[model samples]
Target: MSPLADRYGRRFPYLRLSVIPACNFRCTYCLPQGYHANPNAAQALTLDEIARLLRGFTVMGMHKLRITGGEPSVRHDLTYILRTAAAVPGVTKLAMTTNGSLLTRRLHEWMDAGLNAINVSVDSLDRAKFARITGHDRLDDILHGVDLALDAQMPSVKLNAVLLRDVNDNELPAWLEYLRERRVGVRFIELMQTGDNLPFFRDHHVRATALETQLLEGGWQALARVADAGPAREYRHPDYAGRIGIIAPYSKDFCSGCNRLRVTATGDLRLCLFGDFGIPLRQFLQADDQIEDLVHAIGRQIDRKEQGHFLHEGRTGITPHLASTGG
Candidate 1:
C-alpha cells in the first residue's frame, strides 16, 4: 500500500525517532528551572523494536530517518542502532540530533556505522554561560565533538543554538563567527513555552524576528525564501562559510510544509509536536502484527493529524518537552 499523505497532500516520508527519553543536561528552559534530569514518565523503544518498526515503515515508503533523543549520544547502543537503522531497506538518509558532549570517542564509530549527517545543540559559546544554561560544565567536550564531527566528514553538520532573552542572545554574532570559521551550519531556535518549563518560558522567550534583526544589524545577510523551506529559515553573511538558521516554532509556526511525524522512543507515534495524543505501536509489537499492519497504523495516525499546532493560540495546551518530542 502507498504511504499516507495528509490533507495538504504532503507525503509522510520522514520519521524522527527518539532513541531514549533520558538526557545528561538539565537545560533550564528544557524543563522547569532547576528541574531534575530524570527521564520523562515515558519508556523509550528498545533496539529490536525500533528496527522492526523502521522495517515496517520502510516497507511503507518512508525514506528518511533521524535518530534523536534527550541526547541520542547518551544511549549506549547508539552506534549499533544507527548501523541497524541504516541497513534497513529504503532508508536513504540516516541522521542524528545530539548535545555533542559525548561524541568524543564514539564519533568515528558512528560515522563508520553510516550516520549520514548530524545536528548538534549548542546554546552558548562562552564556557561559563554554556554551563549556566545547559547545567553542565562540558563546553570543551562539546567543542571537541564539533571538530570530530567535521573530521568524520559528516555531511551537513548543523550547530543548533536555542536563543533565550538576556542569556545567550547576545552571543549570536560570536557563535556565527566561531562556526563560520569552521564552515559549519549554525541554526538558532526561538525559545518555546511548551512542556515542563511553561512558567519559565515566559521569562526567557524572544521572537525570531527580533533575533533576525539583531543578526542583520550586526552585518549578517538574510537568505531569501528560508521561511518557505519548512521550519528553519536560514540566512548567511556574505563571504561567510557557515549559514545561520532560525527555528521559530513560537513566533513563526511552519505547519503548511510539515511533512514530518515523530515516533517516540517508546513507539507512540505523534502527528504534530503540539498534539498531545499518539498511537501506541507497542501493542502491535506485542501482538506480533504484520509489517503492513504497523505501517497502516502509522498512516491512520497521520490521517487524524490536525491542520497545525495551537501554540499561537496563547499556548493553551501544554505540549511535551524537546526530549519527549523528538525534533
Candidate 2:
C-alpha cells in the first residue's frame, strides 16, 4: 500500500467522509441555530461517486473510513454508503459518527451493511440537562441503543462529548459511574473556535488540561494510541471497564500526530479542518476512470498541509461550524 505521508512525516490512514451536510439535532456547541440548507450548494456526492472516491483513498493506504455529517444516520441511503465504503479494497474499517437517534431501530441494518464501528454524540448524561444542551430529549433512548450495540458485540462503540464550562464539565463523576461496568469508550472534546460561533465560544470554551490532571490523580494511565486512531489522547483505569479520551485541540502540539484527512459531502478535499481552501474533487468523481487524477490531486495537496491549525492565532479559516466539514 502506498503511504499518503506529507513532508512532515505524518502518514494519513484515516479518512472522514461527510455523507451529508444536514443534521437533525441541534447541539449547543455545534449546531446551536439548527442547519440551514444552502439551495445553491452542490448536491451531496452520488453513491457511484462515493465508491470512486473511496478507491482513490484506498490506493493511498487509507484503511479506516469514518462516515460523518451533520448526522450521517439522517441520510436515506446511509446503508448503501456504508456498503460502498466497506467493499473498497484495503478499506477494512467502516465506521460512522452519528447522534444515535436512529440506532435503536437501525443498528442491525447498519451493521449488516458493513458498519463495524460507531461514535455517538452524547453531551450530557442527565436527561433534562441533555435536552437543554442538544435540543433533544432522547438521552435515555440513545444510551439504551448504545447498550444494545454492546450486547450485539459490535467491534467498537464510543461516545463523544463536547466539554463546556459551567455546563456539562462537572459531570465527570457521573460519566465515571456510567463507565464503571461498560466497555465503551468516551471522549471529551474541548470546544473549538469556528467561523460563526465566537460569542458562544467565549462563553462556553473550557480547557481539557484540568480534566487530564484530575484523571491522573484518580489513577488513569495513558493508553497507547493505535496507528489509525483519531485525534484523542486516551486513558484507561484498572478498576473501570471503560476508557476515556480527550481531544484537546488547543493543547500543546495538537497536530503533531494528525493521521487523518476529511472530504466534504460535495467532494471537496480539506487538508486541514480550519484551512481556508478546499481542492475540488467533483470533476474527477464524474467517471470511474478518473481515479488516477483524483489520487495524484490528493497527493499534491498533502505537501500543502500546514504544520497545524491557527486556532491559537484566533483564525478559523473557511469552516463556519463543525457540521460544515464533519468535525
Candidate 3:
C-alpha cells in the first residue's frame, strides 16, 4: 500500500485515536467549566470497530498509533484496545497519552498489553495549584503513576506540561529540577486557541520562545536536535540527564513537518487540529465490506488537509473540544 500523504507532500505515519471523550478532570485549559460530553457519545466506536479502523490505517502505512482521550485510562476496555492495536500487522509502535491519575494501578497491565510509549499530562507539581488547575486533588496519584512508568522501563515516558502564563508558568524552574532528578523527558507545550479555550488561551498562552529564552538565561544549553516524529524542539542541560522540549504550536507553527492524523471517538478522521472538517469512518466500519472505500475516503480527507493551521492568523475554526479530538 502507498503511504498516506497530504497535498503538501507530507506523509502521515502517526495516528492519534481518541477512544473516549468523557474525562474525570476539568482542567481549565482542556476541559473548562461547563464542558459536556458530545451529544453523540452513544455513537462512540466499539472495540471491534476501533480494531478494524486500526487495521485499515495500518494497511495504509500508519506505523505508529497513539491512543488518546479525555482520559484513555478511564475507558473500561483500555487493555483490550491496547492489545488489539498493538497486534495490528503494520503497527510498529503503540503509545498512549493520559492524565496519569489512574496509571499507578494499571501501568503494568498496559505494559503487558504491548504499550511502548507513554505521555502523561501533568500541568503543575504543586499540590494545591494542581488541584486548582485540574479541579481534582489527585497529584499524588499521578506522581505515583509517573514513578511506576519509570520503574517499568518503558521505551519512552514523557511528561507533557502545557505552559499557561501566570498559571503554571511560575513552576517551570521547579518542574525542570524535579524532572532532572527523575531523568524524565519533559515537554512544555504552548497553549493553543483551538476549541472553546479561546478565552482562557488569550489570558494564559505563553510563547515557547519566551520559555526557551528563560531556560537559556538560567544556564540551560541548547543541545543537538533530536530526531523525533513530533513537533517539539528539544533542548538539554549539561547538568541534567533529562531532556526538555518546547512545542510552540501557535507561536512557532511546525505544520510544515506535520506527520499525524487524528480520529475522534465517534470515528471521524480529522485532517487538522484547528480545522473543523472531517470524514466519518463509522458507517464504513459498520458495514465492514468496503475496505477499499475506507481507504479512498481516508485519502480524500488527506487531500483536503490544509497547508497548516490558522491560529497565528486569529482564525480558529469551530473545532471540537480538546477532549473529543484527543488533543
Q: Each candidate's lDDT (Cα)?
A: 0.77, 0.94, 0.83
Candidate 3 residue 36 C-alpha distance from true site, Å: 2.5
Model 3, residue 286: C-alpha shift (Å): 2.7
Cα shift from native, residue 280, model 3 (Å):
0.7
C-alpha RMSD of each candidate structure in angstroms: 2.8, 0.8, 1.9
lDDT of 2 by residue, 218-259 (tens): 999998888999999999999999999999999999999999
Number of colliding residue pairs in model 2? 0
lDDT of 1 by residue, 213-291 (tens): 8777878776675211336777777767788887887654477667677788778888887786877887665433567
What shift in Å separates residue 81 of candidate 1 from its native position after superposition? 0.8
lDDT of 2: 0.94
Question: What is candidate 2's CA lDDT for residue 181?
Answer: 98
Error of 3 at 131 (Å): 0.6
Query: If both were scored by TM-score, which would come out higher, candidate 1 or candidate 3?
Result: 3
lDDT per residue for candidate 3 within 160-258, as digits (tens), equals 888889988888778777867776888999888876667788898888887889888978776664323667777778778688888888654478878
Those runs of model 2 whose alpha carbons end farther than 4 Å from true positions after fitting are none
TM-score, ranked from best to worst? 2, 3, 1
Question: Can you give the TM-score per candidate against the true fold?
Answer: 0.90, 0.99, 0.94
Q: Model 1 misses residue 215 by how many Å?
A: 4.2
